[model samples]
Target: MKVAALDLGSNSFLCLIVEGDKSGIKKVLSDQVKVVRLGQGVDKTGSFHPDALKRAKECLTEFKKEIDRHNVDRILAMATSAARDAKNGSELFKIGEDIGIPIEIIPGSDEARITFAGSTEGNLKGDENVIVIDVGGGSTEFIVGNRSKLHFAKSLDVGCVRMTEKFITAQPLSESEKQAVENSVDIALDSILSEVQKYPATDVLAVAGTPSAIAAAEIGKFDAEKVHGFILDQGKLQKWCDILASTSVQEKIEKYKIESGRADVLFVGATILHRFLLKMNKPAMKVSIKGVRYGVALEVLRR
Candidate 1:
């Protein structure tokens, strides 16, 4: 069956159509993403903004058209942090109904599980401890497991969009502001580090926007084939993190060709992953393009 999985992230929304069966994804049919900022202002307001809702309606309408083009057999659409936190998150249900694709708001723990499944789909060794770190717009899910069995899964409220909205104010962040962001992340991570480190992950996998943008910057361009399965060196990752903290948003766009929405929160997102590594004492993480949407598709197809 050809299934389409939609990840309605706080920072962006995506639709991925693929042909797959019980074993695993067999072939990719289409993949599309748009940085819609659905979580815009939700951190402070605790509700969806009018402008963000409008953008979501428009973006989802377009995605529906794309889904129709492929004649997908099923659509597994769902929302994350933004929708989960918003008081008017039910708005997504109406929008989904209007688009003829119902959407579900999944819990953070579930996000971690699916991300682990999707990111490590074919890469897992039955006995090796694996940790899949998925940094979305409003939250970051740290999932530690082995052989598809989850041992520790926690979602922290430290994400690119959430952090930038709450802490970042200017381009080329001031030292004080940079420290503030890291400090907050460290504090949140402190709660999970003890339990996460107990697993001693042999493979650390990173999914979602931050890693994708970083991989693109590392390769000097956006090439999916090159970005997927990309590995990060601790030194190089920290170097880029420093460079981003001291750089302007436009420079990121001009140099790496990332979308504006992503450019705004790229540094914060990278910092989350950086702090995760530091806190866990992990050297590096392998990047995976497959994330929530991929996991959603896998579940739908396998069913």
Candidate 2:
């Protein structure tokens, strides 16, 4: 089965095409993400900006073309924190309908569960207690449990794009500014920290844009073969944070060859991951390159 999954994210719009067979699945095609920053300022405004909406619609128009070219068996286009929380979400949906693509505004809880399912189902290896963490554009979702059952799940408003726009104003942020960002994460985490601590978990799995991009940067530095499901220690993650914090976004883009748009949010995302691991009292987390789109494909397969 060849399927297409479009993730309408706050930071980037991703379109994934995969070939699912009896043995396993393989990536067929991936659309280049246009950093529309759809959730830009949504944390404060409670609605999508007019410019962001135009950009999102333009990206979706491109994705719809690709879906048609591939003749995909199923097309699952889901929106996350930004579109889900926006006051004008219906307008966004109507825009999608106009483009002949129906959008699914998945709740944060469902996003967390689907992310966890993809992390576990795709990897086919991990401890019984796997803590799935997805550091997304607008929010972060945490889920801890085994394949059969999810023990705990929650979403936090600590996303890279959101945090960067909100707290990290200065380039290579000042010490005080950095502290402020950490404080914000701590405050937002307070409600879930207690509940997350109650769960008896071991292995930590991180799945989402931030973790994957961070792993890619680290791998580029080390010339690693593959970063999928790579076990990353807190020390290593801290090292990444230090490096990204020190380097200018241009330097990062030139050095790592990362997309210019991604360079800005990398540091903010790293800080969020570092703070999250510290709060969970976990030493390391395994990265999952696969995320919600893969889970959506799995759902299609099951059906």
Candidate 3:
């Protein structure tokens, strides 16, 4: 079967077309992503901005063209954090229906599970203790498991876009603002820290845009193959965070090749990753190109 999987995330909209069977995926037909900032201002306003909605609709419309081109046997679309938290999130569902694709808003726990399945597939050894972290636009999902069994999963409401809107106001964030964001992250991870201690992960795998973007920056390119399995250490993360903090959004985009929409919030994302590693006591994280879209594809194929 040919399947189309769509992830309508808070910061970006992604689609993947794959040829697969009940056993496993065979080949990726197409994969695309657009940064639309669907959760813009939702942290403070409790609703998606009108422009954000419009952009999301536009991106979905474009994605539909790709899906049609592939003649997919099934289309599975899911929305995360932003849509689940926004008071006016139903608007996304309406748009999805208009586009002939009904969107399902998944809970955080489910999101963590799917993320773990996707990020670790073909990468794990079935016995190594691993934790998969997805730093999304509106939330961060933590999944702790070994190769065959999931042990712990939790989703925290501290994400790049949410943190930026909530605490960062200056173009170059002031030290005090940075400190405030750090404090907020610490508070959010308090429960996660204790729970993670119980699991004691041997390896950390990071998925989603934040980690992917950081890997791309480190390698100085946007190639998914290169980014995947890329190991980012604390020192490299700190260096990149400092660079992102000192520069303007456009500068980051132009110089570091960060996605234009992600440039502004990249610093916050880096900070979250840095703090997450510190809390987890992991020296480095391996980046995964696969994320929710890949997970959805696997689910549809099996079904």
Off by over 4 Å in 1: none
Error of 3 at 175 (Å): 0.7
Q: What is the C-alpha lDDT profile of model 2 across 207-281, one tens digit per residue?
A: 767777788887774222476767788898899888887778888888876667788888878887788788888
Candidate 2 Cα misplacement greater than 4 A, ranges: 20-34, 124-127, 221-225
> What does the lDDT come to for candidate 3?
0.87
Better of 2 and 3 by TM-score: 3
Model 3 Cα lDDT, one tens digit per residue, 151-266: 89888889899989888887677889888988898888887788888977778888889989999988898898899899998888889888988888888989889888899998
Candidate 1 clash pair list: none
Instruction: Provide the overall lDDT of each model, using Cα atoms, as 2-decimal numbers.
Output: 0.87, 0.77, 0.87
Off by over 4 Å in 3: none
State the lDDT at 284 in candidate 3.
95
State candidate 3's TM-score.
Answer: 0.97
Model 1: ten consecutive residues of lowest lDDT: 105-114
Score candidate 1 by TM-score against the native: 0.96
Q: Which clashing pairs does model 3 show?
A: none
TM-score leaderboard ranking: 3, 1, 2
